[model samples]
Target: MATPRLFVKGTVLGYKRTRTIQRPSSTLLQLEGVNVKEDTGFYLGKRVCYVYKVGRESRCIWGRITRAHGNSGVVRARFQHNLPPQSFGATVRVHLFPSSI
Candidate 1:
């Protein structure tokens, strides 16, 4: 038998860079239908992927949820490469990997 894989849908809000300094940045993701701060904990440390097409081929960028952002349920994610500005409002998949099972 095969094990089931889990994935949650989320949207990219933007980067975590501050004004006057943009050396380091983190992506912000908002899980679909998840609007409570407490619920964000469930996704911490989970794998996340943002897939986009460069042309006819699709490419994927992976990341992990670092922590919860604020009281509004947004979560912070650190990707191998910083997500582009065009990815804002784009959808991403949060994989339930690195499981404890």
Candidate 2:
């Protein structure tokens, strides 16, 4: 038997540096579970962390108006790479670290 390494915990704070052409791309969410420089954490798959894109003034930026007042935004996180692609949007519990290897 082998022991599993535990990841850290926190909420998503931003979008992934790269994005899809038709939709908001996912990015690294800033973690609140530890110091600002710490890179390890985990998330409970059952809940969603609110995602709001903001500008220099910290005002929410509305990329598009799908409805009368709708904005295009996104939330993303880094998890074990072996997980399937469908797992991208699904609520997930993740163990994140500084490096993939």
Candidate 2 lDDT over residue span 1-101, tens digit each: 88764543333343333365422243333334433332221232322223233465432211210111112122243332222333333332234333335
RMSD over all Cα atoms, model 1: 2.6
Candidate 1 lDDT over 33-85, as tens digits, reads 77989988878899999999988999999999999988999999999988888
Backbone clash pairs for candidate 1 read none
TM-score for each of the candidates: 0.85, 0.25
Model 1: CA > 4 A from native: 1-5, 19-24
Which 10-residue span in candidate 1 carries the lowest summed lDDT? 16-25
Model 2: residues with Cα > 4 Å off, grouped in runs: 1-5, 14-23, 38-92, 96-101
Kindly give the stretch of ten consecutive residues in candidate 2 with the minimal lDDT sum.
61-70
lDDT of 1 at 1: 100
